[model samples]
Structure formats: C-alpha cells, structure tokens
Target: MREIELSLNQTQKIRLKRALEKLESLSSKANSNSNASVSISDSIPVNLEDGVLKGHGTLDLNGELVATVCGVVERVNKLVYVRALRARYKPEVGDIVVGRVSEVAQKRWRLDIHYSQDAVLMLSSMNLPDGIQRRRTALDELNMRSIFEENDVICAEVRGIQHDGLHLQARSQKYGKLERGQLLTVPPYLVRRRKQHFHHLEQYGVDLILGCNGFIWVGEHVEVKDDMVEDQVSKPEQQKSNKNSISLEEQEQTYTPIETRQNICRIANAVRVLSILGFNINIEVIMDTMNLSSSLNLDIHEMLGSEFCVLVAEGEAERRSLTKRKG
Candidate 1:
C-alpha cells in the first residue's frame, strides 16, 4: 500500500481521502479512461489491423505491441508510447533543467540531472564570467572552478544528446550558477512544461526556476549585469579592480533579511504542499497556494500542519471540479 507522508488526525485523513476521491472521479469523467496503464511485458490494447506503430517504451513481440515499462499508455496519432512516472528524466532539446555539478572534468562539468547518466556541460558551450566572446584558451580551462565548482547548482538548457552523453548548454544570461536559494526536488511528473518556467515574484523579490527535470529552485532575485565591453583599453583595469574586491567569506556574511527569508520559506512550503497533494505544479497554482496562505494569515510553519493539508486538498478538488464544469 502507498503510505501518505503527512501527519494527519483521523478527521483530517478522512477529509483528505474524500477530497482525493472526488478529484479522481472528476478526472475520470472529464477524460476517456484510455489512459490506463500496463506493467512491463504486458500486452497493450490496440487495433493491430488499423496499423499500430510502436513508439518509445514499447517493444514488438511477435507482431504484438508490448509495454517495455510500467506507465500510462499514450497514443499520438498512430504512435503508441508509455510515459513512465518513476523513471529518470528523458531530456528533450530546449528543455530548461536544473542540476548539480558532480565533477569538474577537463573542459566540461559533469552534472547530475536525474537521468540515466550524468549530463555534460562543455566549457565552450557557455559564456565566460566577463562575457567576453573569444576562443577559450588553456587559462580559461584552468579557471573552470571560477565558473562552476563541484556541488554548485546550475540551470541550463538541454542541447541534444551526443555520442558522449546528454549535453547541456548555458549560453543565455539566465542559464548559469544559482545562488542564495533553496533547491526542492519533487517527482518530475508533477511539473508540466509550460511556455514560461522562469517566474520572478516581484512582490516577494523571489526568483523561481521550475526545471522540467523536477529540480525546482527558489532563490533571491539576481539582476543581470550588462557585460558589453565597449572600451577595450579600460577592460584590463576593470578586471584588475574586480580581482581586488570582496572575498567569498565577506560576501557570504552579507545576511539576508528576515522578511525575505520568511517569504522564501513560504514559497518553498507552498511547492512542498502542492507536491505532497499530487497537484499539477504550475506558476498559477503555486501563486494561488501562496495567496491562500497569506490571506488566512497562517504562520509559515502552520502551512504544513495537518489542517492546512486537508484544506489544500479540498481546495484543489473544488478547483478541478469547477474547471471540469466549465469544459
């Protein structure tokens, strides 16, 4: 049996169960139950006479379509594929992903992006800290630690997989090392890819990066500095000026305000609650959850209490029901 992780009393548990049941009922009614899942080697129902095409996560066994993994069956036109929820992330081109640097190898960083293998981010694929556009030299390779050290969290885009392995590139300003934040990991299925994954909550001064790989980052808003070097003569002096400045310890001592810390906790907890409830995690739903907590004036710690969990479940059930009705 699946265990519910939340600490709930009898009444809260009952309410949550009822709310979840209602949600499941509503979902089944809105869509065809053809999304039925099958286990590995199980025969999937299909009209073989109509020319069925086996896709990913499927195998042809004696001219029969068999599921290669345990997952929900999806049909796109004539193609049939199984979408496994508990499997490693399958990277697609242009997907924004958050990963931790596991190794600083020669001219590349090995990133753990929750895939079958570690993703590689080549040094030549990314921009320099000073944003200079030129051929990378041995000095740049020597200074690789300056850009990303082991265990540093980074956000980048999936550049197609090569013979080496899954490749990533951080060519844009937004794609680089993340700092002053918290990283939250949830099941990748909970997060749906949307047109916009990067959200800046101006109200709370928080930057939220919802990685398609299920690694969510909530951090302090960082302003992107203009790196255009207009004058060639003064560049060296400016570089020297930067080298003489603050140490890492001094920068680390710059404390974050209590209010910002509280806000971060609030948003992080909001994501946590949604993930626990198995709700679709999008920016709008996250904002709604955050607003609900703020409107109720609930303590930051109270947001994860049993009562709040039940309330959130009920709210999600109601929200989905209303959406179903509209459709």
Candidate 2:
C-alpha cells in the first residue's frame, strides 16, 4: 500500500497500519466479489461471446483482453476500462481543472495540469478580463500577458480533446486567475467527480476549488463582480480622469485581512493533513476533520504531529465503519 512519509513512532505506526487495514476491509466489501484490480499485462476475464469492448487502459491481445496499465477494472455494460490511480489525469468534457501557465505561445497558453501532455487554452476560448466579447485581433494577442502572464494559476473547464491536443476554456467570471491561496497536489483518484467543485465556506471566509485534475486550490473568497457593468462605468471615468495617479496608501489597503489569512492557513493545513493520510477528500470529510481539530484544541501545526495523524486514521476507520453499517 502507498503511504505518505511521516515521522512515526512504533505505537503510532502500528495504530496507523491497523486503521489502514480496517479501511481496506471496508472498501473490499463495497467492491465486487471478483477482484476488480489488475496488474499490467494481466489478462482480464471477459466473455468473448457477449462481445467485450476494450476501453482506455486495455488493449486487444490476439483474442484475449489485456490491461495496458495496473489499475482497478470498471465495467459499464460491455465496455471495460481500467481506472489507473497513479496515471496522469485523463480529462473529460466539462471537467473543472486548475492549472498554472507554463508558456504563453502564439495564440494559446500552455498549462501544466499534470496530464500526459500540456493542455492548450486558445485566445478565442477565454473572455477578456474587462468582459468584452469581440474578435481576437493581433492587438489582443499581443496583450495576452496583461490578462494571464507566465506562471499565473488559472481555473478552467475541459472544452474537449481534439486531434491536436487537450483544450481548456475560461469564458465566465468564475473561471479565471486565482490569487492569495495555496495549491495542493494529490493523486487524482482521491477527488471523485461531482456536480459542484467550487465551494465558498462562509464561516471560514475561504474558497475551495476541487479540481478534477488533482490540483486543489484553497484561497480567500473573491466576489464575482459584474465586470461588464464596471467596464462601462469606468470607461467614461477613465476618459475624464488621470489613470496613473494611485497613491501608496490606496495600494496598501488592498491587503488581505489577518483573520482571513489565518483561516486560509487552517483550511489549507486541514487539506494537507488529509492528503498525507491518503483519505478520500471531499467537503464533508474535510470539514469534519477541521471540526475534529477544533474540538481537540489542536493548533494548526499540531495537526501534522504523529499523535494527530494516528487519531485521524483511527477516526477515518470509525467513520468508514459507520458508513458501512448505514449502507
């Protein structure tokens, strides 16, 4: 089993292993009777008479169906595929993802989203920062850096996979550059696809983006402003007033609040602890872990301690046991 690197004593290690074993038992019961996991080049047991269709991670070998990767097998009707846990993200249409700009190419931006290849965000696919919709002229192409420069982290959607490559789009206000946050990377399998990925924690004043590509973003909440109306209002004001006369005091006022910053750290640490534990990550589980920390009066740093890790593991085991009973 894969385990995170931690400084664990003998007792803590034993406890953690016991919890992990219990979790495995729970998961094994929920899965099919026949082992769904397979190794590379393993021949899958499929009825050829029923007409088996090979999907991703599987290849036809003479007459037998063989897996091309080591992963769990999933069968949907007659179509069979392997869901590889350690493989690069395989994007589907409309998957919300978070990525960092690797390069600003001619008319497209290359983003590193931990895929087999970098994803492309064409100039035409995104809305202008000022919320203007028009033809993308050479001038717009030249001013691309003004919108998203190199190394800027952006949230976008998987438009589709073309013959050329994977494509992404950010056409709405919600899909844009992220700021004042920490980006956490984990195995893509931990984050299950769901209807809603963008979450605003009103109590904590933080924004969480559970990207389908395993890039998790936790940041201060940013209000979605009506950029079109603001653009219209500011255009006339720009024509009448000087634009470059901002004072240092006004710039300093844009700083994030100390409390909000603390909240951001707390939430981010909670995610990091969960990832280190190799647990399934969701809003409910994350918030529950946070509540656990608070209930025990564990400081933000103490959450990463050996005792806390063991406690979290034991807690997760109990939670899964309860879920199994409910099921």
Q: After superposition, how far is residue 269 of candidate 2 from its true place, in Å?
A: 1.6
State the local distance difference test value for candidate 1: 0.83
lDDT of 1 by residue, 1-327 (tens): 124688888888899899989987886665455586678999988878898888888998887889999877889999899988676677899998999999999999999987889999999999787788899999989988877889989988999999999999987777888877899998888787787788878889788989999999988776665455211111111233355597988766656767888898999999998888878789888988989899999999999987887888899889988887897
lDDT comparing candidate 2 with the true structure: 0.83
After superposition on all C-alphas, the RMSD of every candidate to the true structure, in Å, is 5.0, 4.4
Q: Which pairs in model 1 have colliding backbones? A: none
Cα lDDT of all candidates, in order? 0.83, 0.83
Score candidate 1 by TM-score against the native.
0.87
Least accurate 10 contiguous residues by lDDT in model 2: 231-240
Q: What TM-score would each prediction reach against the true structure?
A: 0.87, 0.88
Tens-digit lDDT track of model 2 for 1-327: 467589998988899899999988877777657557788999988977788888999998898999999888998988999888777677999999999999999999999998989999999999886577999999889888777778988899999999989999988777888888888898887888998888888888788889999999988877776554211100110111233576778757757788888778778788888888878789998898888888999888888888887888899899989987896
For every model shown, the clashing-pair count is 0, 0
